[model samples]
Target chain A: MNESSLPFFARGMDPGPSFVDVLRRLAPHGVAGSGAPDHGSALIDTVHGTTVVAIRFASGVIMAGDRRATSGMSIASRRIEKVFAADDFSGIGIAGAAGPAVELVKLFQVQLEHYEKIEGEGLSLDGKANQLGGMVRANLPAAMQGLVVVPLFAGYDERRGIGRVFSYDVTGGKYEEADFQTNGSGGVHARNWIKATWRDDMTRDEAIDLALRSLFAAADEDAATGGPDLVRRIFPTVAVIDTDGFTSVSDDEIATRAEALLGGREEGAGL
Target chain B: MTMPFYVSPEQVMKDRADYARKGIARGRSLVAISATDGIVIVAENPSRTLYKISEIYDRIAFAGVGKYNEFEMLRIAGVRQADVKGYSFAREDVNARALANAYAQTLGQIFTHEMKPYEVEILVAQLGETPDDDELFHILYDGTVMDEEGFTVLGGLSEQVHESLGATYKPPIDRATAVRLGAAALTPADQAPLNAGALEVAYLDRARARRAFQRLKGPELDAVLAG
Candidate 1:
């Protein structure tokens, strides 16, 4: 709160438009650091679970994540949110260690806003993806301690006039996926499901259905992932980013889609 | 070593104030007015890249005149302060009042203690949910703070601009009218009206979500001026 009280000379040596750098210089511990001891031995004891998928379509991109966080054989949280708005035109979905993943998302959000505020313009989509890569790289220390966080970043690239998807490794290696990407415990299942159904030039409805079906398939096979809970009305979080901006799908719509999918599965079993 | 001749405290302060004032007077003027929906800032700046008005937070905006380097430093400091505060606390808690006070403290300290005072005049404007809550804090070169309602002008020829603005300014003005009024005030009586390209305009619209600060430029600026 009293950040302005820093000496005039120090203020003059501003870290030049990077909020993360400024935080690192002023509050070193706040930015991801390497001091924490490794928890690799008991990694399963900590909260870990996810199935987040991002698919690029004709208009833009669709990002969806199931609401589940588990520790070992126990469910830690049932309605945990994993998808967040990176900015107006971008979205991020996290999977891996819940605590560190959420922290990384918060930091990424701040970094983008900070850059925009200081530079008087938002960074290009490429610049934003690269920035996230740097943050993930910095979090390498935490990742080595079994607190790995892999996030899926998707956004409507205004300059390129299309939606783009970028996935990352534990050490901040960024890979631009041509079609779709998935992360978390059930990522493999979700990825296979998406590969079978995904098609270029798909409409928004088809893309949404594909995202929901992939998440459903992941939840069906992966014990850590949670499926839609009809009694509790908990559905996967889905966000659509396109030319207009980023908008999250409503829970009612998701429920409707989940019900239809369930009905089709029942009929197929009977047949 | 001979003893240095002692200058009176009042004389030293006066000299510093005069020096600061002269540096400020060499620059063009800027204005901020409370509009029907939010706050609008207009500056007679020809450079498209060098901004004189900018956003400091979601609801707060900053405008500076006098020295570009000095004011830009202040602008960046304000942004840092706001961002840090919002990060530490809630975003709603980052208001203009605290930022203006911080600027005053720094400018005042430098004016009296530093070898050379900073030559800058800055305004911190926060758009409230309602027109009655809008605030315009004008901080002068010597760290003098003025909490003005309705409108305020800063920099060289401020008195003339103030008079022109006061004569035409009315509460609850629309965005286009506010821009025209500010443009008229910044223009000298003998000179023709300024075109959109020569002016820098920004607004903190209350209706805007989260971040309210937006620049009006190119065709948007031309359209507003034409309107």
Candidate 2:
């Protein structure tokens, strides 16, 4: 709060390049997750986001998430974006409690940008994953109260010239996936779908189609997940992270693909 | 009992100003010019790792001349202040004027209270939607700030650089011309013009989306210099 003095930390108390640490130091209560729970049986049916998937291909990684949030078997939001670019090189797809999950994504974005500005370079892919792990671990108290948030991180590691994917548990346990990973109420279904079709040499277009199909399969089985809505003209959000950088696939392209895929399914069912 | 000689307030202030000026005069010069694309900053720095110009916020940039360690410390502090403010409030609320005032207050306090004043002069530039909206603030070691127009220069040889830059001080020029003008102004009259390898260049490109600050180095720097 003191604007005159420089925000210099003592050698022992320095936060270094961690922006989350700076926030924690400034406002201890704000970054401690939502609030204290009453520890009662009556659970809060907070809005929950569902079904995000990431797949690695030859050139880079493609991430996709449904635009649906659920609250006690009802649709809370039909157009909620769950996947976001953490920085230029990495993409993050979040699931679980919508409020805390979105907040965590915002914080993660600022953390990466802040560290890059202060340190004059971005963190390594592994370093960024570890930073997100620490943040998820810090949210343990809220996660215990049924407000869990698990995010899947994927990036094009320029150093190794390969795309990598990482997934996290509620307790902040991080695990690197070899090819693809998924999370949310329909994670298992989507993972099964991707596991069957995912190949090591998948092209960008193939990976994108596979991701959309997996989300479609998940939505068919899970009430929380929403499928592509043709009436509303709403399609799943998709993004690609490559050596060039992170880019969102346009809605027009995704809509076309969704229609084509749906037409094939409709014809097969008619038989 | 040892009795200290009482010095006049004016004399003490004058001596501190002179000392600070001498220290600043020993460093290489830096120039910043407002252009059509963005604001270009060029410094006669050979070291690639140690930056003389840096980003402070989404649309703001900071450049300093004088003691490297002192300016580097100030650069880091400015970044912290800007980042913290942006995080606490909305990103649009963070501006160059507030940051410049903070730097002034700190420098003024040190100039009067500390035994020795910091030997650094800094520039804070903010990119606007239009060329006329661009803001550049030049802050001296004694905490005096000047609202510069179009372009500003800092360092021991600022007077010479200013004169050289003024001859071709046209607003809304292209980025390459702005860089060339800045590099020309920073170079001494008797010496050959500086090349990309010996200069550090950066700009707050208005064409960018959020964070506008970008450094020009290696092949990119060479291409710009050639342009």
Candidate 3:
């Protein structure tokens, strides 16, 4: 953003491969918390996205998120996408303050790419998670102003040849989730559903179905979490990160799955 | 005190320019050709770990042919500039012209003010929606920037390679043909032919989503050349 000069730093003073570090050196107050709202005074009812979940299957990881952003008791939006591909092999799911959450995802994506280009190789899975952690830590000032952002990170680790998921706290503490992880207002309900149905050797289709079902269950319990809106044909956004790469499940397919899921529930309720 | 001899500014500049040119002339050459899909870049480099071409942004790519360290520094700076700009504004806002101008300013400043000029000749290529919109910028060590059409060459053998490439290149070429042409042009007349392993190839594919730059190596490189 600084006018047209190449960002060449002196020896030992370089930001290395970190894009955030470069931002700090060039413009100390450029990124997060720049113009954050004051902490007190009945914090603004900014839009808040909710309920994103990640489940690890045999081959890789599948992340799914409901399409809802609630401002106080009102639905601010019905098609807010929470799940995003962090890179070719990884994905991110966001929750909390909608504005800052989306911004964090954008910044995080740039961070991964920036490091990859500068270092001539991508960061290790663990390293990517830690990098996101540091970014979350940087957002602490903004988080305190009632714009807390908690994100779930999942990726297919090339070295380990398995899917990995990481969850973070507001304080930037990162924890690896072995089987699965869920976050946001409906996180508990979704996690409960996943814990009941998830298995070690589930196929890709099974994993995707389980992810959709978990979001459905969360939506049933949490008002902020949106269920499949058949009238609008809006379904939860889903993405799978595998050895091949990150691929999003198409909306048409998700719509069919949502319809089938509801039909099965209807039959069970009748029974 | 002993009298100190003074050197004229013009002579000093000429000396610096010559030194930089000599340093650049010792390195291998690189070529970028515009094709239907994107711009293909081929460099005659044997070192697997070191890269002469790399992605700068979603659509922009940076390539340098000269002293590896000096060019590498320039490459990293270009990445930083493009990334920072994309972060601040929209990705589409970052363009080759702006990046080329920035590089020119930096090199010019160093050449005019510093004790020594950087021994690097760089290329910043941006893939356009159509073949005609594609842009190639060739920048010199002394901060001169040339907006090239169709194809551009960099490094010590640029004049010869450029001429050879111009003879064979045709517009709207496909990826495979572009790679072959670039490779053919990079090989000097007196030297033995370069194999796949001895060359580093990459392209900025407009058809690709998001980051468009991709490297051609190993089996892929072999396949393209063989084709």
Following a full C-alpha superposition, what root-mean-square deviation does model 2 have from the true structure? Answer: 1.7
Tens-digit lDDT string for candidate 2 (A96-140): 998888889888988898888889889999999999998899888
lDDT tens digits, residues B128-163, model 1? 888779999999888899999899999998999999
The C-alpha stretches of model 3 lying farther than 4 A from their native spots are: A37-42, A267-271
Worst 10 residues of 1 chain A by lDDT: A1-10
lDDT, residue B90, model 2: 79
How much is the lDDT of residue B190 in candidate 1?
Answer: 100
* Residue pairs with backbone overlap in model 3: none
Ranking by lDDT: 3, 2, 1
Candidate with the greatest DockQ versus the true structure: 3
Off by over 4 Å in 2: A2-6, A32-42, A267-271
Q: After superposition, how far is residue A202 of candidate 3 from its true place, in Å?
A: 0.9
TM-score of 2: 0.97
Interface RMSD of each: 2.3, 1.8, 1.2
lDDT of each: 0.88, 0.89, 0.90
lDDT of candidate 3 over B15-50, digit per residue (tens): 999999999999989999999999999999998999
TM-score of chain B of 3: 0.97
CAPRI tier for the interface of model 3:
medium
Write the residue-wise lDDT of candidate 2 on B102-129 in tens digits.
Answer: 8988889889999999999999999999
Q: How many residue pairs clash in model 2?
A: 0
